[model samples]
Target: MTAEFTKRDYSLVGLDSKLAEEKGLANAEWYASEIPRKRMKELIQRRNGPAIRDTAIWFILLIASGTAGYMLWGSWWAILPFMIYGVLYGSASDSRWHECSHRTAFRTKWMNDVVYEIASFMVMRESVPWRWSHTRHHTDTIIVGRDPEIPAPRPPDLLGIAMSLFSLKTGPGEILKVLLHCTGRLTAAEETYIPGEEQHKVYRNARIWVLIHALVIAVAIGSGSILPLMYIGLPSFYGAWEQLLCGLTQHIGLAEDVLDHRLNCRTVYMNPISRFLYWEMNYHVEHHMFPMVPYHNLAKLHEELKHDMPVPYSGFWEVYREIIPALFRQVKDPRYYVKRQLPGSARPAMPGPAAAMMTE
Candidate 1:
């Protein structure tokens, strides 16, 4: 934020609240520009190849990690770095699972499903539930009540109010939450699920996965002497931190909480640093606009969309730059706080062409 945001900086929020005033809900598309069909294609993933790659890499890490764990077992100190690598490896591949869930991991759908389920069961806590819920998020990005990732209001009670004001260390706080959730001492279900999915098949799938998780936990525990904790716990912690930083640094504060393009999401173009570390997710705005676009091609699509797309806003690092502030900030309700007009903020965008209807 101290980077001294500019007119271009404000574009990160694709739609502005004013558009809602210009056009009613049903015909909102008039308010925004369509993301080009050609551009969308560029972002789509050829996931099968990558899915296979992810599985192979992760499998190797897991096996090599166990050997490393046994060799370093007695030296509690040595176990520390191995734990870090295990989690980082798992965490990195976690996004690979995201690709699989969308069935973008492989050219063949069946292959994707088989591979995705295996990976999902290993690292994704609520695999099926996550798939269904996340699909909804893509379908309806920031739609206040609809999006699974909606930020809950700061609790109204006095203690809740007091706690909201205090800040915790960002990295460690995220790590702890993951650890606690993994142990079952706390349920992150609320952090993930909401009111509508109770009757869905995803609930059934989630239950089965949970049972499977019990087995994984048991195996992890049998390793004893905190070895299981190191193998599973450390990775879970690292993965959680990655997820938290990714979300917080990207979204933090921008537009209102509408699912429409205007307030929902934004994209970032790439620099070498972002491209390498984020794997092209730096084009956050473009990805939000065109969800089918794979992370690998997001940067390219962003460049193309720049001229034709009448974005509500065009800003970068909105989430990444303010990681610490976002962790402590309550980011809902007041919606967008704007001091000027820019990309996405210029108007509330109406919906674009309906995405190709997804089928299982």
Candidate 2:
């Protein structure tokens, strides 16, 4: 028998766009749980204090880890420090890039810009293009052909997913994009979301990144050691595991082309350290539901909104248990996806062609 939800084109300039619009899924209003205006105002209020403290701690950890890794270089003692450094440099920077890009992490606009630029370079995301790409992501969520940040496409490349743990395929691909952008070229997909005016900024940021990488390589060559790269260019590869682990849980195995965050996004209860490192992004549903709410307030938002959401997975292991099998099944059945079972207390799933296509 044929699968019910056959794979469709996921690119922006494809049949899915027309399908999405016809089905009223393109730029549609998502269902958000009701909260008092006053309370939401407080929750969404941007503040410098929390972000400043968190950022200072993040930098302190990075500096301390880098120093330890350098002092311990060429010794077994280097392993732990380098590992910590890699997680901070590669994984944590991802959240910082995300939050700062939204310009909601810090009340000060310049502070957000400074952190966004630094974190973008660290995570290998082109600041300007990705900013627009993510804007499209928020505007369209997981509607196929619209959301640029959909991590797992149908008939998922399991090998690519595995390789991304080490940043092998993704790292090289992003570097190639950066190189191309440095020449003032944008990919066809990038052109879909990135405004023409912002193209120059993309080229500028890519050139700056190329120059920085060149300097790091030069220092490594001069010293006849890979130490410089281990600190700079290479950590993004070695230390990407944690970020991937947290990120994959966001939408993998979940419904797509749907307007409900509770259906498409997973919220796993994570420990304090994981929350810190992931920047509370594990509250995935809450983040998607109200993107403007700062990270520090996600937990409170989750508490306020949980009654209307599907029960969150207890933790990472629990979610992975479900996701791993769903992915394995999707390997054989490309149309398959996980349909989250919503609690009775939850609002009904939004009615649409996308919702009708989903199966539990």
Candidate 3:
């Protein structure tokens, strides 16, 4: 028989949610490789040193670059420093937001919260709502109707994806959401994941963000220059490309509604600089497989679990080579996806109740 492809509904309010529940995909138990309890404990150990050091360097570079950009504002030289500043503000903050949100970045809970709040603001993500949204993401992964973070949905908006490289599409929409949240309102989809008790925090965070942006705009008006925004508000848009590149690789074109992370996630080898900037999230499969493990320990975790997982893509180029074409084909054939093949040496995917219930 020809390969079967069904038109899928991605909306939280749609039939996919009921179908997912019936098929045992919503809040399903996922397949995880067997690891000794002791070994798993060692990998999950939390520490403050690495995150503290990395965060310090990140802030220092952001400050230095912002200063240089400000000083060079009248000349073409401003471009270089601003670009550097934007990457730190927009891109680096994303990974920091992610790690800290998991509360795995720092040994101290307060430190993680502090950095999460700061990074959330920098990346224009409201802390409370996004935390819950991400919680659902981890629980349901790429399952249709359950995951709100699916980057390139089927019949993908190619132009929107291209514009998102610079945050042109998502940034404005996120800002609008923040503004709406400031009015103590949330969309129905957000309400699905965000608890009523936490809505207040979302509203408060939105107000703070709105106030900060307003203050920056006021400064720009008072000085008759956009320098304040360049250093603060605008970099989120300009410097978002790197994060987009990294984020898309996590699950784009991968299998959905599966219990196995190896089928749905990617692990790409990255250079030291990229590794540091991304906080080692390049080990996407490892992260999905065991999010409790801290970022510093993901490489070790990858080594331990690699035998059970699909072979990783060699690097970003390897990922893009597969992803770009997959995306192109998906435009015409929404049912098409990249199927990962495991090596002969790889262990079988862990069986779960959900596995038997998987829909075709």
Candidate 4:
């Protein structure tokens, strides 16, 4: 006789959340590759130069592209500049928001906060709420019902995944959440992770976001042109493809509810241009394992940890070749997952059953 299979609850307040507590997965200690304290300290040391230089270039590109798009408006030639602008605003801002939120992107506290808020808006995330949400993500990475940041939940919604490339599915929900927060309301799901003390900040930031968006829309209407919206608001929709492309590789087909970043997160090598846009988040396993390490230093950290970790994907194609198939298989067998293989030098995986019913 076949065993019954129930889909895992991915909700933060659902049955799995309670089960995780019972099973000792919530706030659990995870496996980390061994490294000497001095070497670890060196890798986590904060610096300003790399982020400063990269941020400057990012701003310059956005300005140049936006300017070109404005100049070429009403002509087919404008497509090129607008495309570049969209990617920079929509996609690149994701990494900026992520890195700055970790407070490791810059040495100066205010600089990180400044960029974090701006990038948070650009990425259509409420800064205060998402900061707390991501805190939960790190604390309980991929632990079902506790990780609020699982981009692609299982029995994978392939259509939703496709639509995310253009922000078709998530963009509306994000906008709705912003509008709801503007009215001083928080969704129950958000309230689960966001503390009561921080709720006011969420409302305040949402109002600010609404005001900025309203002003942009007013300018577009008064000027009788869609140009303003394109630069300010629409890019988050149109330019979302690259962000989705690289972001999916972070954990789409990896293990869930495991006490090991090595099992759940993936690190892949990317080209220089992709690295710049993603801000080196391709070193994702390293980031989750050592969240304090600055984006600029992830490569060095990867070298230090690679000997004791599973081999990283050579690039997007190689990684997706493994991921895409697993996602399809998951459509039929929700328990299917890509079980990562540790190298000989690696310590054994933490001894616990995955909270989800996973078949390697």
Best by TM-score: 4
Q: Which residue runs of candidate 2 sit more than 4 Å off their true CA positions?
A: 1-5
lDDT of each: 0.47, 0.89, 0.89, 0.91
Model 3 weakest 10-residue run by lDDT: 351-360
Angstrom error at residue 105, model 1: 3.1
TM-score of 1: 0.62
The clash tally of candidate 1 reads 37
Give candidate 4's TM-score.
0.97
Models 1 onward score TM values of: 0.62, 0.97, 0.96, 0.97
lDDT of 2 by residue, 133-159 (tens): 899988898888888888888888899
Residue 95 lDDT (model 1): 60
Cα deviation of 61, candidate 1, in Å = 3.8
Model 1: CA > 4 A from native: 1-47, 76-80, 151-204, 216-224, 259-263, 268-279, 308-320, 323-360
Worst lDDT 10-window in candidate 1: 4-13
In candidate 3, what are the lDDT values of residues 23-113, reduced to their tens digit?
7788888888888999999999999999999999999999899999988999999999999999899999999999999999999999999
lDDT comparing candidate 2 with the true structure: 0.89
Give the C-alpha miss distance for residue 52 in model 4, angstroms. 0.8
Task: For each of the candidates, give the backbone clash count.
Answer: 37, 0, 0, 0
